[model samples]
Target: MTSDISHVRSLTLDEALHENPVGWFQYRLLLMCGLAFMADALEVSLLSFLATCAGADWGLSTAQEASITSVVFGGIICGTMFWGVFADKYGRKMAYLAASTLITVGGILSGASPSYGWLIFFRSVAGFGIGGASVPFDLLAEFLPTSHRGQFLIYIEYFWTIGSMFVAGLAWATLSQQGWRFLA
Candidate 1:
């Protein structure tokens, strides 16, 4: 019993992560997470501002405009559920990569949409990708030192607010001057 006890080692996840000083890897993780939050904010808010412009350009009724805007939310709901499950089954990095691909492809297709139906479909695809944004916060928290964990998450969330503001400014500058396509 004494010999067996001497051979055993204990190195828990808490000890391994929390005992180390914050380093480049942690900082990179934070930056990546912050950027995901920013992209989510930008994509969500861009739809809201563009709704009015797109409606006018397409000569759509209020209901149609609302439907176009709301489809993204529906996509978000599905995406959140699907990606959440996928992340649990697989890994966060794989989920992030797949989601990011969906978002990029969706955005490009949305911009090239030749009809209202196509626009809705592509935006929904983009919304699905946006769902991946939820994973990073959890991933980032695990890597953060316990002492600063909560505060750092709060600070990282501010990137969403910044992203919202940025899109608003961008919309004002480009949407009005260059038209909706340029903004998209």
Candidate 2:
């Protein structure tokens, strides 16, 4: 009697993704996602620097300053909740693009703001974009193979620190001689 043997094996999504080595696509994804974090950090910290300049240039009161900051965070809270659900239903890519566009528009409009109220509104719009920060992380995590996932995530966080530093450097270069509007 003779016996026949089979030696084919198949892998599930998790198994295949987890076992694969990091590649160019993963690197590009990491870079893009890291940029998202950097943008978030920049927008979040920008308010502190801009608020001071705006107060001085516009002669705003303490209550106005507080309202500006509060409104931005409030918008962030609402955006995070709404965008998270939107990302789940629509897609992370769409949510990411929408958030980025919002941030850009908000920043531009804030710079052009004629009054404290407009500044607050634009900053809130920017904050809404900032709230979608988690989308990139979620999308990136899904792509990363398990082997380097943890380390890559930590690396992505460094981009945020870099963004904070970048904003400070920008403020130092532009804030003293120029108005806050230019910096934004």
Candidate 3:
């Protein structure tokens, strides 16, 4: 009986180690989350650049352009709350995937928008995804060990900034010649 118990305990430990696999599993998860974060940041920066082109091309007044930006932010605020609750109830992976999908779809739609109003609507939809994805940052942080959690979280922020810069550069390159529709 004692030998059997020892064998079972050893097997359970082996299984756990295999499941985690030298911390590679966590790293994979982190990479996925980081990519999602990058996408969110890219969408935001692109929207800002596109707003300028949209205003100029559409002959929108300054006030109208400002309103469009405001509407998107407002939608983001609402989305943050909605996503927070959903994240708590559902798993992190599911929430992140859903948010990413929304952002991608919203970005494509926003790029293809013919009018300022349509752009604002799509931007708002993207904002919702951003808001939902934001909650996962905290969840990810919690999953990491104390020694590494802060570093990983900081890396996420860093990646987001990098993504924003990348998008900004792309905007400058594309918008300078072909205009905003090139973004689509």
Question: Can you give the TM-score per candidate against the true fold?
Answer: 0.91, 0.92, 0.83
Measured with C-alpha atoms, the lDDT of residue 7 in candidate 3 is 44
| RMSD (Cα, Å) of model 3 | 3.8
The residue pairs in collision within model 2 are none
> In candidate 3, which residue pairs clash?
none
Task: Specify the poorest-scoring 10-residue window by lDDT in model 2.
Answer: 2-11
Give the poorly placed runs of model 3, Cα more than 4 Å off. Answer: 1-22
- Best-first order by TM-score: 2, 1, 3
Q: lDDT score, residue 82, model 3?
A: 84
Query: Please, what are the lDDT tens digits per residue for candidate 2 over residues 1-184?
Result: 9655556568876688887788999899999989988988888888788877788788888888777778889989999998899999999999988998898899889999988888988999999988899998888888877777788889899999999999999998988887788877
lDDT of each: 0.83, 0.87, 0.76
lDDT of 2: 0.87
Residue 172 lDDT (model 3):
73
